[model samples]
Target: MSLRKIKRPQGDFWFDFEAFAEDEDGFWLRGPVGTPWRAPHATGSSEVPVVVLLAPGRPWAAWWVGDPADRRLEIDVCRPPERDGNGWQYVDLELDPVLHETEGRVEIEDWDEYDESVRNGWMTADDAKLARVVAEGCAQLLHQRSEPWLDRGWKMLPDS
Candidate 1:
């Protein structure tokens, strides 16, 4: 997988995206093609990953080396991703679990929204736990400078 530095309100960091593809063994394979991420097996065997964003120590947030061991984020929701007018999608209102990095720790940008989701039955307890696991896992994976942070298994829709 390839990574590029991006500047956004969430924070500045290296980012990349991946698509899932069934491998020869039928298990899903992810990542670009070549290099460390060129080939990575899916951990959960999920056929299609929702959407994700990850960043390293925080060059976007200011180069703060983070502890990959830390996992204390309260995942609030994992609603359907909001898509833009052009069809590009991103986490946004009604379906967003904000992530942030501070002093080497991954933090949730909003617990209120997450709580509200639970209060309104917008997100279930089980789904909340799944979201938490995904966020925490991302926190750990993004701590390193390796290509793992930019992984995307090369599962993109063809431009026909």
Candidate 2:
């Protein structure tokens, strides 16, 4: 199946992945290295295996990248994903909490873009507030390494 991410004021990104597993929380998707992905401006294949967790009612999606040098974990603050056909789709809230394992730190990224979206009315005030809350909470979880999905996703990674 494919996961589609709709970015406010801009593009749509989609990637095909195996529906590897599912539980009470939500679905788990696995994309092997070389899996193709497309965005409005560009297209490419993943350089490493990836696992993503999309939990319904949670305002974020968690991703685990297999490469150690890369940002190992990234949480995209967004609206809860909705099932679409055989896939899922959500509108990105723009803020993201990324864990760079090599650096041993978590960074909140894309704040500028998020601010722009809010200012331009690409997102409503309530949506912007929700995004901020989710982003901050996710960042704290990333910093403390306390999110269960993070560990679950790590373990699910191939050869983790």
Candidate 3:
């Protein structure tokens, strides 16, 4: 009889979120998506992310060009049920208008309560919402430009 071959899985090793959580201070650094945000340090930092103001329990994520080397950010988010409401859904935002007047960075301040049905669909739940704000913060803080990264990969993946 001929010998049979076994198939192995591909790609990187499994990521341990629990371990990651134990190491970090907050669950999220850049802040959560959909919820209103305020920039406590927007005018400062020159061209780097200083800080983001997020309601307690929400996640925070941001992006910036780090030391010209391998760089990545670990992110975490609160589930929908855990949140207070649906103010962060994809159909209730106006990103273009928000970033239009800014030089390159987009600073979010005065996060008044918002209804999910009104906000535009610029971002989603899966895309580490904090990262989007961080990216915009970097663009504005440094170059006064902003480009949202919503629905980017969704077009490629099959719908659930």
State residue 156's C-alpha deviation in candidate 3, in Å. Answer: 28
| TM values, all candidates | 0.33, 0.92, 0.18
lDDT of 3 by residue, 85-142 (tens): 3222111121211222213323443232112312433234443354345435533532
Per-residue error (Å), model 1, residue 71: 21
Best by lDDT: 2
Error of 1 at 140 (Å): 1.3
Error of 2 at 107 (Å): 1.4
Q: What is the lDDT of every predicted structure here?
A: 0.32, 0.88, 0.24
lDDT of candidate model 2 versus the reference: 0.88
- Superposition TM-score, candidate 1 onto the true structure: 0.33
Residue-level lDDT of model 2, residues 1-160, one tens digit each, is 9999999767899999889899876899999888899998999998888899997888899888888567478888999988889798999999999998778788899999998999999999999999999999989888888657667787888652
Better of 1 and 2 by lDDT: 2
Model 2 stretches astray by more than 4 angstroms: none
In terms of TM-score, how similar is model 2 to the real structure? 0.92
Q: Give the true-structure RMSD of model 2.
A: 1.6
Clashes within 3 Å, all models in order? 7, 0, 28
| Candidate 2, residue 86: how far the Cα is off, in Å | 1.6
